[model samples]
Target: MENARSGNAGKHKTRASIVEVAARLLHEQGTAAVTTRAVAQAAGMQAPTIYRFFEDKDALLDAVAQHVFTTYVAGKRLVEDSDDPVADLRAGWDAHIGFGLANAALFGLLTDPNRGTRSPAAAAGLEILRARVRRIAAIGRLRVTERRAVELIHAAGTGAVLTLLSSPPQDRDLGLADAMYEAVMRQILTDAPALPADGTTAATVAFRAIAPKLPMLTDAERTLLSEWLNRAGDDPASFDASHRRG
Candidate 1:
């Protein structure tokens, strides 16, 4: 048992070290520097050893991206939410923008549709955004459905980073992210929870946040209610049919 445990620990250590080296290479010299040979040499291991933990260069790159994003998510999850959900949401946005700008190569890898869409780390990041948007909806401040609010914030953040990155570092418009955030907020938020006066949109969003927790409803009933609520929450007042993402 002791020998087996030692072997397992050693394997875990080797994999972690390889991933660490690859992540450093990616950050310092971009994706081309993260090849299996480069990583193995940097990690002081044979290239074939990388195959024991990862199938190929793509898998190696995936692990590197995963490790980098997982570290960011760990720290992000530790931030305590304040009494003000909007303030918390803006904090998250700023952190996301800073992370993207700092880890340009990793951000590029994780935003590539073919890889980003398939990454668990990216999905976890999106879940964090969903929770932030859900809080605003629960407070009745959101004018759009939770899904729409999340989508708008995500799209804007990505665009903000890409636009900033396109410019020379010395010439980048740092305030564009703030401007984009305000634009999205204008579209998705109200002055406050106006309920019956602001009408069904905010009410539907607030209710949608708690729909699954209605203990009196059966599972099937809750599912059906959620479907209806989703339709209503994304109704004409909340969603414009013409602006859907491609």
Candidate 2:
């Protein structure tokens, strides 16, 4: 049992060491410098030993991306959530832009179309964004559906990072990310003081946030009401008439 425990600990340490070496190479020399041979040499291990922990270069890159992503997320999670969901969302956007710029190589690897769908780290980040959007909806501030808001924020943040990264540091427009966030927010959120004219939309969004917890409604009733609420989001007049008839 002692020998078995020792072997497992050694394997875990070696795996972490390889990932750390690859991450450093990626940061200093970009993706091309993160080859299996270079990483093995940097980590003081044989090339085949890298394969024992990772199936290929792609797998190693995935591990490096996850490490960077997880580290960034841990730092972000340290900041407590604010009472103002909009402010929280803005903070999240800034953090994402900062992460991408600071870890350009890792960001590029994580955003690669070939690996993004398979990246657990990327999905975890999106889940955090979703939670933020849900909070906005609960506060009756969101104008669009939660899914739409999430997509818009994600796309805007990704586009802002890639745009900034493409330019020389001195030439980059630092305000571009803030502008993008504002543009997306305009489309996804109700204006403060949320006019009575837009009350139906705001009410629908707020109720949709708690639709599942409606104790007076049966499962089937809740599902049916949800469909109508979704439709109401598109055509308030028609939904009002249908509700009157019911």
Candidate 3:
């Protein structure tokens, strides 16, 4: 029985490996390149085995997309105990941009029509962000209309990061992404009361504003973003121009 169990685990791993490899290839090359026969050859598994895991090319692609997005949200840092909302929020946005810019291909894959299903990963991000927003809303700093803030924040961040990733070296800079994020946060928080006199709570408010829209993540691209967090809001190409990158 133990041997049988081990065999099952091994089979699961092999299937997972195939999914990961196929997702990468599709992201890097495109769906046409990831034929069942090619995946079988690459994974060193038979084509028949691939069929056992996925019904057809479309099924495989859907699974890959779900896996990629799910992985991206699982890695986010949603602060629970922090007193400084603003700084925390900025940190969260920076992390999001870093994740998206570094893994733009995965972002493309997850957002692609062929792969846009909301998996556990995308839902997880929304859940985390929603929780944080609820906390901030409790503070009276966030207005009722501010509920829409989360969507706006994500749109801004995703748009900015996509720009930075696609721009030329002379035009590309992650700092620009940070700036764009900050501008949006300030606009959102402009009407709110000043934070705690000590400033930590106010900072926390700022943090909460940006925390929900953390980054564009997909399981296909797992590398986390560190540099983008530290620099914080340096837009070289300018906020307007960064949005124009193809």
Most accurate candidate by TM-score:
2
Pick the winner on lDDT between candidates 1 and 2: 1
Name the runs in model 2 displaced over 4 angstroms. 193-196, 214-217, 234-238
Residue 9, model 3: lDDT of 100
Best by lDDT: 1
RMSD of each: 4.9, 1.9, 14.4
lDDT of each: 0.88, 0.87, 0.64
- Which parts of model 3 are misplaced by more than 4 Å? 1-7, 26-33, 77-81, 143-146, 168-170, 191-246
The sequence of per-residue lDDT tens digits that candidate 1 reaches over residues 1-246 is 999999999999999999999999999999999888899899998999999999989988988899999999989899989999999999999999999999999999998998899988899999999999988888889888888889999999999998898888899889999999999999999998856766777887888887777799998899877776776676743333422421
Q: Could you give me the TM-score of model 3 versus the true structure?
A: 0.66
Candidate scoring better on lDDT of 1 and 3: 1
CA lDDT, candidate 2, residue 212: 82
Give the per-residue lDDT of model 2 (tens digit) for 1-246: 999999999999999999999999999999999999999999998999999999999889889988888887777768899999889998899889998999888888888888777887788888888988888988888887788889999999999999999999999998999899889989999876245477587778777887887789988898899889887777777888898998
Q: What CA RMSD would candidate 1 show?
A: 4.9
In model 1, the worst 10-residue window by lDDT is 237-246
lDDT digits (tens) for residues 68-130 of candidate 3: 766766666424547755555666777777777666666775555445545556657666666
